[model samples]
Target chain A: MEEEAKAKPRNPSGPRLCCVCNTRRAALKRPKTLDQICRECFYEVFEEEIHQVIVENQLFSPGERIAIGASGGKGEHGLLSINLYFCSVEDSTVLAYVLSTLNRRHHYGLDLFLLSVDEGITGYRDDSLETVKRNEIQYGLPLKVVSYKDLYGWTMDEIVKMIGLKNNCTFCGVFRRQALDRGAAMLKVDKVATGHNADDIAETVLLNILRGDIARLGRCTAITTGEDGPIPRCKPFKHLFSKCISRFCSGVHQGFGKNKVVSSLTIRNCGLQKPRAILDIIKSGEDFRISTSTKMPEQGTCERCGYISSQAIDRATKVIIPGWKWCKACVLLEGLNKGLPKMGIGRSRGLNNDRKDAKGNDNAAKSIESKQCGTLDF
Target chain B: MQLTLEFGGGLELLCDSVKIHKVSVEPQNGAEMLTMKDLLTWVRTNLIKERPEMFMKGDTVRPGVLVLVNDCDWELSGQLNTTLEDKDVVVFISTLHGG
Candidate 1:
């Protein structure tokens, strides 16, 4: 709201073509004003293709209220409003957007959302309350905020204290994933969609294999699902790459250059540096359709949460799986010192050969197979 | 026999000395012979029991940990079947799995 805060960067970069189409203006080039069309177009195309997957797989049902994990970041903030704004013109009631609970990490109300959870953290809950009081008057959508202490056994800070900062990010990633699923079930929503785009997926794809992560490598590309968890998940931007997503973000920034709200993010080290060394692996696969040879991975569900955990070792070994279903990323984080093999568990299963030897479950695939969307196979 | 052996990623965890598992053979009328399966079995018997953490049960070996009877992945074929010729260089290497 201050003049100093709204100042644009000196010699700020001009707009570029949308990464999705490369023909339209990208979102990253916009002012703090409202000419967010280029971004809207990209979102429209991305969502349309996503909807195709939904229709083909019947991933959702008519009139079902689906929750979008709103981080108040570009990915989730204003998600319902933007998507609803588009739907208003298209008039498709096949799905309705409901604001799901936000994971109020230590920052709580400091982040951009108005939802608050009852986490006993005085400032966080109070900030969330203030946000609710402020946003309710202007925003009409329903909001549910989840707290850090609940979904995760510990908050980001607490996690960092338990496992050093370097390992804490993995805690956040793992918890965000598990929490999203748990929160979706609580909301009684049919599905949950997160704003993970192509760059995230592709970067993750490369990182998984670079670490020789066989389990996660197999599950990263889907637009509408994940390991055997309670609620099915969808990534609307599964095909949208980083350059495109950034353009959209920038366009919205330029258009609403003077908007009351701005992204207030702080976390920066997303464990992204690991993939830098593996660029040639992806390049080789793309240029040659060849992956380096890897081992035949063993797949087993976690004794803690039935999700695909490679450490379970014995398939029939029944154990009181915990309520949490961590991806290989989460499992690998437990011991940062274990090197590639430990980290490699629950990663994608490719580097060589077309058919990835199944390191995760494909058992119930037949349940959804009969309902598979012919045109939208992920 | 300067055979090069290579392993990938975690191959460093394998036997400390790459060549510690090599075997020598004498052929007909004082000739020597050996095979890939022989090498694998040798690795299993000598290294596996002494230092179990060195190798995984079934991971694909990298070129960095190569066991070239004449310079190739012995597991590719001709394991014990591979005939060791004179001056056969069984090389083992440790390869990276970067993209």
Candidate 2:
């Protein structure tokens, strides 16, 4: 009864003002600092924060062409209660919009292109691609889409039909990694920027550590990765929380499968209690030191497709097979093409037993995929 | 109270793909005023047709769900304890979904 009596009216003078502007009603509580601020101030700080990250990290060089890995995963159709809110598309959608906006507003002198990978999921990719198309026109940026069917002679729909939904994400995830790179190569862009936020990175840090993937664990926390490869990738949102990102950027409506739910649950729950914990986890991951004698996989080009691969070579036989020296994407494609859908599904160590290797790796990739969303793969 | 409820960021999928709902909610047990905690119970029972876990965890929204009242964040106004007035617009957007 005491608390009920204290409930103030809608426009009571008790409501706090924006901490930054000291005028408008504070609309959001900042996750990192717990700063309650108005919408206008939030946008200002959010964009400026990202811009600062870009400048501080030198994510780009002026006049260089950068490809935004836009998956139409941002504000597709959601509007804030006030008219100031932009319509939603999805995460990568917001990545594209925000990057382009920052580029222009800051005069970064960058030629931005929206690069999308069409995994051939009819109902899913088609709809999101439409959002990306809208972003193409809306942002005045050229769009390039590379499809699995074109590159690998298979659509995800066909792949799922062949392999079923069980290990489907593995095939999709492996193929998607290559698809984005190939798409960026096609665009001839200098770099690829993904929409991986702080939460995503933190989730990845946990996933990699749990999986004991020392290689990815070492590199996952970097703001930019694969600098030595053909295309480098940067995450301007490496510091921003998904909560804040989704609030302003909006999110895509997709299947909330059980795997995604379970994987995100731990970090998501932790995030609710302490927003800074996400960044701290990433920091811990970065500070993690793997012993040099651990025999890390040496990076090498897949002898078969020339894509970057860390797969060990088959010394006994020079032949490149499902369990041989080929990129994961190519190996999965070989499995599909060879009518042995199990090939490259798991560990590539056993050359004599493809089926057993496939079964083991299938579960492995499935667990990895469960933690990943959309085109983001470790 | 006549409140407008909007769901986005894939939260709409749980509620039959309908993004917005306008409903009348009265405080239960003849209480004089309504609070967000009460509205959430009502919305969970009435609006969310599937996967209630995606929308709510325990009593408040799932950790990733952002709640805004009249274009202001619920956290600023006191979260679940925030009092709701007539014609208030409460929006729930899930950042958990999507890439």
lDDT of 1 at B76: 29
Expressed as tens digits, the lDDT of each residue in A214-238 for candidate 2 is: 7778887889888887888888888
lDDT tens readout by residue for model 2, B1-99: 788888876778788888889899999899988999999999999999987877888898988788878777787778888888877778887776432
How well is each residue in A221-273 modelled by candidate 1, as lDDT tens digits? 55565436455666555443332333333222211111111111010112122
lDDT of each: 0.36, 0.71
Each prediction's RMSD over C-alphas, in Å, is: 23.1, 7.4
After superposing candidate 2, which stretches have Cα over 4 Å from the reference? Answer: A1-13, A72-89, A250-263, A309-324, A348-378
Q: DockQ (Cα-based) per candidate? A: 0.01, 0.43
